[model samples]
Target: MGDVFAAVPGAVVDETGLQHLGNPLAEQRRLAAGTALAPRADRAVIAVPGEDRLTWLDSLSSQALARLQPGVGTELLILDPQGHVEHAASVLDDGETTWLIADRADVEGLYDWLRKMRFRLRVDPRIADEFAVIGGTAGALAGVAPASPAGLPLVWTDPWPDVSPGGWAYAPVDPHPGADRDWSEAIVTRDEEARIADAAARGDLQLAGLAAVDALRVAAWRPRWSADVDERALPHELDWLRTAVHLDKGCYRGQETIAKVHNLGHPPRRLVALQLDGSGSVLPDHGAAVRVGDDEVGAVTSAALHYEEGPIALAIVRRSTPIDAALTVETADGPVAAAQEVVVPPDAGRTANVPRIPRLGRRQASQ
Candidate 1:
């Protein structure tokens, strides 16, 4: 693949191994305006080939896939036995192969799991390291002529900022960030990366770093595997059902827990958007305690300075935390007051419409 940082001055690589241009704020604005594109170096692609591929994956993931349409964008999650998200992927198929855009951190594990699960199925899952992902506003690259070492490229448009089929929206507020989200990623051969980067470097095309992309993601209330998730995190808590889940899909490993939670239970915690008091220069890191008064109620999952929202963050707080609670995030600079905005409301589930049992007193009176 292309090393975008090696050829560009003032480019920095992030913790996730992606090249980021130094000017994040400017980049964020440019991208939202469709004037810039981000190289998704924090991600990798895997290709699943064979006639059995679609059906096989459908049997194992949260999204139904046996009849998936080509070029239609969707996503999948592999949940643990407890229905906690274990892995997630943006999925697209190009007639012959199912392309999976996975978090760089989850690639190996997802590959291993697929390989082990392919007992006798004629499917092959292999890394598409030859392809590098470029993300930007919808249709930004639509006019880019194809010149690739791996034939025609594939594209996966994010369905986030919108509720996909069989998914639910917990963000009750109107005019949510996702309402205008236009993120899309296209995969081109590694050779194309340098050309794209060079063009971006020359200002022939605009360039954005990962920081800008992340800020936009946070503003949209999107949940990502590497940054926003923990061992106990559930899809409902992150409000990820907007894109990464299928409630009525066929049984998978964690189906029981998923069904129970959505049908009769609520997530133990819920996601909130935090507008930080940016008086101090410090930005809270992931895992920074989020407190209501002196009591810890949650922790910051992602934090960034939005080009529009100034300082904003995403935190998973106790479900019982009052929706209007004034919270603070514990930062190295002591504490920064955070105003909460609901992403996943405390009453996120109960969709199964499981019948509520009558209280003992009520039942006795009725009897």
Candidate 2:
């Protein structure tokens, strides 16, 4: 089942399946219209079983999952002590098993960590290697059957860009672009994966690739664990609080930092959408330096050529960088000019508004 999409004609698949089917723009259009499916070969599933699964995960991550109802979908984040995002997962629970869909690169580390954390807890976390993930909007994925191990579909519908219950939003845009994002990932059995692959190869079903889906994600200002996260990425910077962080949730590894940043401090950096100058075939690669004049302020996290938007990117820049400043991204071909669109603004945090108390024995009072 390695790279199930490899047999599809014109499909260019690497370690991650199906980069494109010759035309990325056409693929993007089909995907956006809910007419194509993307084999998420780069994603892996982890299953947590036993009765303590939900509460155990609730105690360990950023989302409050203690009372999670069966068949509902959500997400969670594992943060380091200093509040840096280390792992993130899209979560779904059937009555008997809790399934986590996560970036393939982080699965081993996350599985090991989960195993280590089960200190006599009745939870068993195992990587479900026999299952694979397929992504698409609900409409496009309706025909596909999801894995139903516990009598429930294991589809992790994305709850992005919307403020989840108990979650907070730092981005102040009235109409967030992510409102139109209807993305979901479904866990499929090996048989189902092969069936879909055969259908795609026969030209019976259209398929998009990682590149096309990523472009749509960037356009929606949706941040994903693999594309937007770095060693220093705080959920606030990426506006991930909208879907991932629960403000009043029980204490987890990095809850303190999450509270502090949202209540009294601002994130050191903020995410911004860049409308890149579509003059060349060069798109900025991840970690490409982003600059204002001669000063390097940030780096591109994700960039893509969208079907409708031409070229666009998402970058994390210093919080104090002026909103109106013109920006450039350094690529091998040279500098590409970019216009900035605010995702998280400079004034994003400090929401508590606690009044300052007067100091005791002020000069006026003493006099």
Supply the global lDDT for candidate 2: 0.88
Off by over 4 Å in 2: 350-367
Candidate 2 per-residue lDDT, tens place, 112-215, comes to 99999999989999999999899999998898999998788888899987889988776655567777888999999989999999999999999999999999
Candidate with best lDDT: 2
Which runs in model 1 stand beyond 4 Å of their true positions?
143-153, 351-367
Q: Compared to the true structure, candidate 1 yields what TM-score?
A: 0.92
Give the per-residue Cα lDDT of candidate 2 at 302.
Answer: 96
Worst 10 residues of 1 by lDDT: 358-367
Clashing pairs in 2: none
For model 1, residues 1-367, the per-residue Cα lDDT tens digits are 3466456656787566544677899999988988887888889999999999999999899888999888889999988899998889999888888999999999999999999999999899998887788888876767444223234357788898687888877776666767788988987766677788777667687778888999999988889999988889899999888887788888889989888888888989999988888677688999999998999999999998887677888999999999767788988889887877778777777553223222111111111
Residue 124 lDDT in candidate 1: 97
Q: What is the C-alpha lDDT of each candidate?
A: 0.82, 0.88
